[model samples]
Target: MYRLHIANKNYSSWSLRPWVLMRQLDIPFEECLTPFESDSNWSSFRTFSPSGLVPCLEDGERVVWESLAIVEYLAERHAGIWPTDDEARAWARCAGSEMHAGFSPLRSLCPMNCGVRVRLHAIPDALAHNLARLDELWQQGLERFGGPFLAGETFTAVDAFFAPVAFRVQSFGLELGAPSIAYVERLLALPAMQQWCQAALDEPWREAGHEAEVQESGTVIEDLRRLS
Candidate 1:
């Protein structure tokens, strides 16, 4: 049996990675939702994960922390989690690793808030750099491997790694034209993605931590409320 511990469905980008991957792949696992208020409250996470972080995977006695590490572990067991072709697998792994490590500016400036539909006043240099790089990488994969998903027709960990970004793009209105835009739409339309988003919508526990994180950046309109 496998247990996956995740934080806020609305705001925990790292937590979304493996959760989406596992759910999309139909891998059976129990999910433990950890409510987070602030960094100080993170110590409570240690009960389920020694790392004191959400998205930790426990497979019986074996435990894994770090988002990418969990994905890699799952990939080792489920061959379908990664691309079958050697070159494509390498590309996918590289893309996943890159997403794990780089693009700090975009992540910081545009926090993943699935509930909101907001737009920035202006595109700052750092964020623009990250977005440009993201669009380039996404487009490259679509053209090179022939998409709908990043790396090919099938949804893999690479797509899961970027899943939060798709939500961010939808919510924040970050413009990544052509196939990148279409790709984001496709990701959002996935049943697994819709399930995650709706759970976030239904969740009533709004975290102060997330609100404070994105409050000063720009304007935000909670999409659900607007629709209502």
Candidate 2:
């Protein structure tokens, strides 16, 4: 059996990728969650992952760190996680890699807080740029592949890669065009997403950093700032 070590389900976006992929592929794995606290020890994670990050996967003697790497590894074992068509597979890989490497502004401004809702009072220019690019990408993918998903009717690694973005968009009330809006709805409707959200709702852990600034209307953020 595979062992996957992850952080909090409510906040760890990176951890979600491999977890979602595994669940979607029906691959059985043992999950271990490590909380993020000042007093939390890092030695255990460091020993398992060279990068000292959550979302580390251990399959027997093989160890894989990084969410995308783990997803790719899992894809190797379960081929259908990627597209079957050669051209579509290439495009899906590109889209997934772009999501893995880019979107820093979105990550910083809107941390994945599944339990809290926040509205943006003012979006920073960098975040605006990031959102614009994301919108463009989503539009292109939808138009090209004719989705409910990035690569079309089926959910591929691309969808797994962008799932957190869908969560962030919903959490922060980000404005998406028609296609993107429809796409988000489809993502939210997924059984795996529902399961993930249910798990997040059941978790009892809370942190000050995860708290949102609540106004009379709702929680709001004044500016976008990258956490790291």
Candidate 3:
């Protein structure tokens, strides 16, 4: 069985990507969750991850780091990791790569914190640009492929890559057009996503840095996290 190294369910957006992918696809993997340390996780994560990051995959002797790499690794051995149609597959890969590399504003400003609901002070122009692009991209995929999912009728790696963004949308109450909004809601309602959300809300440990970042964007109007 594969062993997946991850971090706090509440704050580690990167960790969520591969985790959700594997879960939704029914790919079996043992989860190894390491809660974040106050100062730095570099030393701790370095034990298993070359990049000293969560979401590293350890499959027997083979190790995969980076969420995209992990996805590709799994794709090599598993079916349904991506769309079957050549066009859809190409578009899915491109969308996944864009998510892996771009969206700095959304990634930084609207960090994923599933356990809380925030009332943002304001959405900056940069974030607005990102949101507009997100809407456009989602609209394109949905229209082109005709789907409940981004690529097609099924959840694929592309949907997993954007799963954390769904959490961000929920946490910050970020608004989008009707289609995108419905898309976000659909992602959120997935059984896998709901499981992740419950775990996040149930987590008792709180990392100061992540908590502070949430404050940088908005007032946490409600904290749904476990108090004890």
Candidate 4:
């Protein structure tokens, strides 16, 4: 069986990706929940994860770190982890990769806090730019591929990649075009997503950094930020 190590359900957005993907795809795996307090000897993430990041996957001797890498690995094992169509798969991969690499500003301005509700008093210029780009890209994908998801009728890796962004949109009350809004609702309504959100709400341990981020409303700096 695959072993998946993840951080707190309340804060670690990266951790959410593979967990959601595997769960949604009905891949059975053992969950290893590691809290973020690594200074303590109890923290297991430091020892096994090469990058010391959550969402590390262990399948026997092989190890996969990074959420996208884990998702890619899953795609090798499970058909339809991405889209089935060649062109749709390519578009899905492009969208997923873009989500993995870009959107630093949205990530900063509105971190995912499933358990808490936050409202951003002001939209930073950089953040606004990112949102606008996301809106355009999202609309284009929906128009081109036809969705309730980024790719098509079924949920693909692209949806998993953007799932946290859905959390951000809802958590911070960020505005989006009607299609984008409906898409976020569909993402949020997924069974896996709902399970994660409920788990996040049930978490007893809180990270100070994440808590502070959720409480703070205005803008964010590069050194600090967050989600799903």
Candidate 5:
């Protein structure tokens, strides 16, 4: 059995990627969730993950770190990690890679906080650009591949890559076009996402750094998380 190490679901967007993918696809793995320390997780995480990062996969003697790397590692053994169609698979890889490497502004400006409803102070130019690009990419995939998931009729790695964005859009009330908005709604409605959200809301651990980042980004209108 594989052991997947991850952090708090509310704040760790990187952790969400592989965790959601495995759950949604019915891939078996033991989840080891270690909530972030109020101070720092570097020393603690280093014990299991070389990079001291969450979402590290331990497969027998081998270890895989990084969200994208974890996805690819799973894809090697999983049948439906990516689309089977040649063109769809290529496009999914490109889009998923773009998500892994790009979208810095959206990531920083609207950090993932699943249990909070926040009103942003302002949408900076960079954030606006990121949203525009997200809209464009999602539309292209849906139009080309046809359907509810990013790559096709079924969910793929690309959709899992953007799962955190769905939480972000909901938490910050970020606006997108009709199709993209629908896409976000669809993702949020997924059973895996629903489970993640419930776990987030039920969590009592709140790291100071993550809370500070949320306050820095915007005014938190509602905090649905359970009291610490």
Candidate 6:
């Protein structure tokens, strides 16, 4: 069985990616949760991950870090995780790569906090640009592949890569076009997402920064659930 070390479910966006992939694929794995912001020394993570990041996958002697790398590794092991056709697969890779490298401002401003939903008062131009680009990408994907998913009928790594973006857009109360809204609804309807949300709800660990932000915004955990 694969062993996955992850951070808090409520805020670890990178952890969610490979975990969602594993769950969606019905891959059996031992999930070891390392509460983010805990005093626990993450020395063990360094042994497995060069970057000392969460979402490290240990498969026997092989250790893989980085969410996208882990997803690609699993895709190699399980064929259907990526689109089969060459052209579609190429587009899927492009989508995943863009997600892996782009959207820094959105990530910085709207950190994933499954336990809180605070409306954005002012989104910086960079973040707005990122969101606009994301809207265009979603539109392109829907146009090229049709409704629901980035690569059409089936959910792939590309979809997993953007799942956090869906959460961010919803959490920040960003305006989404009809197509993007529809796609987010499809993503939320996935069993994997439901499971993740449930787990996040049950998790006890809460970062102080996130808590303070929630308090300042006057948004509670219940408010966050409503956003979902």
Error of 6 at 110 (Å): 0.7
What is the number of backbone collisions in each predicted candidate, taken in the order shown?
0, 0, 0, 0, 0, 0
Please give the lDDT score at residue 180 for candidate 2: 88
Per-residue C-alpha lDDT of model 6 across residues 18-98, encoded as one tens digit per residue: 888888878899998877664443676676677878889999989888888898889878867998877778988998899
Report clash pairs, candidate 1: none
lDDT of 3 by residue, 177-223 (tens): 99999999999999999999999989888899988999999998998
Residue 196: error of model 6 in Å?
0.4
Instruction: Between candidates 2 and 4, name the one with more favorable lDDT.
Output: 4
Off by over 4 Å in 2: 39-41, 212-228
Better of 2 and 3 by lDDT: 3
- Between the candidate structures 2 and 6, which one is better when assessed by TM-score? 6
Count: clashes, candidate 6: 0
Provide C-alpha RMSD values for all models, in order.
1.7, 4.8, 0.8, 4.5, 0.8, 2.9
TM-score of each: 0.96, 0.89, 0.99, 0.91, 0.98, 0.90
lDDT of 5 by residue, 1-228 (tens): 999999998899999999999999999999999889987899999989999988899999999999999999998998999999999999999999999999999999899989999999999999999999999999999999997899999998999999999999999999999999999999999999999999999988888889989899999999898874
TM-score of 1: 0.96
**Candidate 1 Cα lDDT to native:** 0.88
Shift in Å, residue 86, candidate 3: 0.1
- Candidate 4 regions with alpha-carbon error over 4 angstroms: 38-43, 218-228
lDDT of 2 by residue, 34-107 (tens): 87654443776787787888889999999999988888888778877888878778888988899899988788
lDDT (CA) per prediction: 0.88, 0.80, 0.94, 0.83, 0.94, 0.80
